[model samples]
Target: MTDTEIRAGIAEVARAHLGYEGELLDDTSLVEALRLDSVRLLTLVAELENHFRVVLEDGDEAGIEHVADLVAVLRRRIG
Candidate 1:
């Protein structure tokens, strides 16, 4: 998938997981914007893996801060 498509997929998974009713911006901070706790983080990771069929790197788990980070990570893995 292209980067835009990857980001869109990530946003869809995030919105579904968080029950968010609005758009997820590129710069939205995951922790501050979504208040993602460990369980929710795990769910997001699992869903991303299932949705993308790509395994996340350990660095991704630790480094993701904004919605864009997911795009960067997946772009590297799948692009």
Candidate 2:
């Protein structure tokens, strides 16, 4: 999938899991902006992995501090 599609998927997951309706900026912190706890974040990860058919490493998310960071990880995996 393309970056746009990956981002859209993330946004869709955020909408479904976090009740987020606004645009997700690059700088949007997943914890702060989306209010995602560990469980919700894992749920999002699972959904992304299933949709993209990629096995996301635990380390892949270590440095993911923002929505853009998450998109970058997905981009690498999907590409």
Candidate 3:
């Protein structure tokens, strides 16, 4: 998938998992914007992995603070 498609997929997963009703911007902070707790964040990560079919290493968990970061990681893995 292209970067845009990857971002859209991740955003959709976020919206669904976090119970967001409105649109999500690319740069939105998952913690601050979605108010996700640690458990929810971990859930989001698992959902993204399922969506993208990519295994996330423990070190990779550090860079994912926002939707943009998630998109970036997906892009790198998909590439």
RMSD of each: 1.5, 1.5, 1.6
Give lDDT per model, in order. Answer: 0.79, 0.83, 0.77
10 residues in a row with least lDDT, candidate 2: 33-42
RMSD of 1: 1.5
lDDT of 1 by residue, 48-70 (tens): 88889988877776677888876
lDDT (Cα, 0-100) at 32 in candidate 1: 74
- Assess candidate 1 and give its lDDT: 0.79
User: Which pairs clash (backbone N, Cα, C closer than 3 Å) in model 2?
Assistant: none
Query: lDDT order of candidates, best first?
Result: 2, 1, 3
Q: Encode model 3's per-residue lDDT on 1-79: one tens digit a residue.
A: 8778887787788777877666566777778776778888788878888988888778776767767777777788767
Query: Which of 2 and 3 is the better model by lDDT?
Result: 2
- In candidate 1, stretches whose alpha carbon ends up further than 4 angstroms from where it belongs are none
Clash-forming residue pairs, model 3? none
CA lDDT, candidate 3, residue 46: 87
